[model samples]
Target: MKKNKDIEVRIEETKKTISGSTYDVTELYIGKKKIGEVLAYGPKEFQSFMDNEELGASKSLDLAIESIIRQWNLHE
Candidate 1:
């Protein structure tokens, strides 16, 4: 699970409210930039997205990071 050192990963727990119901959302960030979000409860736990583009989903964060690296073509 090697990643570029310059690329930072952060997961934040957030609360979203809709129709008087509140739910938790996990947001993915690279450095200070936001990449995408995933629901805490879902079939695809590590789904990634950016600017409305789906970066595919994986069962682990390592796989998700790999997808992001390929998508952005970041140097490892």
Candidate 2:
């Protein structure tokens, strides 16, 4: 399995708000490919979405990355 360091993340600052809040949605990427998106409210608060599915919220970005990799069956 690939670790967080192995994945390249690119955050796109969107002007759209989430849940009626001002939180921005950031897109996750590995190299030139987008893997998922995250609605990050804080450092320990975020909601991850991938493959047109909501992967839910979590406290750690590492956890979110791991889940994305696992759910997508990505290999190093």
Candidate 3:
């Protein structure tokens, strides 16, 4: 995929407590400078699979970008 100059993507491991068990999840960040509600790689897609699975940083970024592009197309 081509690089996007307007948006920045970052992913990191996050720990959350669920049923008293610590779970690690891959968190995807896009356009940190523009903060607000986002749909890319959001809970709707991420939580569809099993929880606590390791999603590579690049994979997360790619997925987020793809989602954003698809959403952008819908508005066009």
Q: Top TM-score: which candidate number?
A: 2
Q: After superposition, how far is residue 53 of candidate 1 from its true place, in Å?
A: 4.5
TM-score, model 3 to reference: 0.37
Pairs in steric clash, model 3: none
Model 3 has how many clashing residue pairs? Answer: 0
For each candidate, what is the lDDT?
0.65, 0.71, 0.41
- Model 3 lDDT tens row, 1-76: 9784564546556666667775555444454521111222443443312123332222353454455444444543
| Weakest 10 consecutive residues of candidate 3 by summed lDDT | 48-57
Query: After superposition on all CA atoms, what RMSD does each candidate show versus the true structure?
Result: 5.2, 4.7, 9.4
Q: Best lDDT goes to which candidate?
A: 2
Task: Name the TM-score of candidate 2.
Answer: 0.59
Model 2, span 1-76: residue lDDT tens = 8566454456565745656778767676767888887677787997788967998888986676667767666543
Candidate 2 residue runs with Cα over 4 Å from true position: 1-15, 74-76
lDDT of 1 by residue, 1-76 (tens): 8775565678788877757876666677777877666543344476666556877777875566567656655432
Give candidate 2's total backbone clashes: 0
For candidate 3, give the lDDT.
0.41
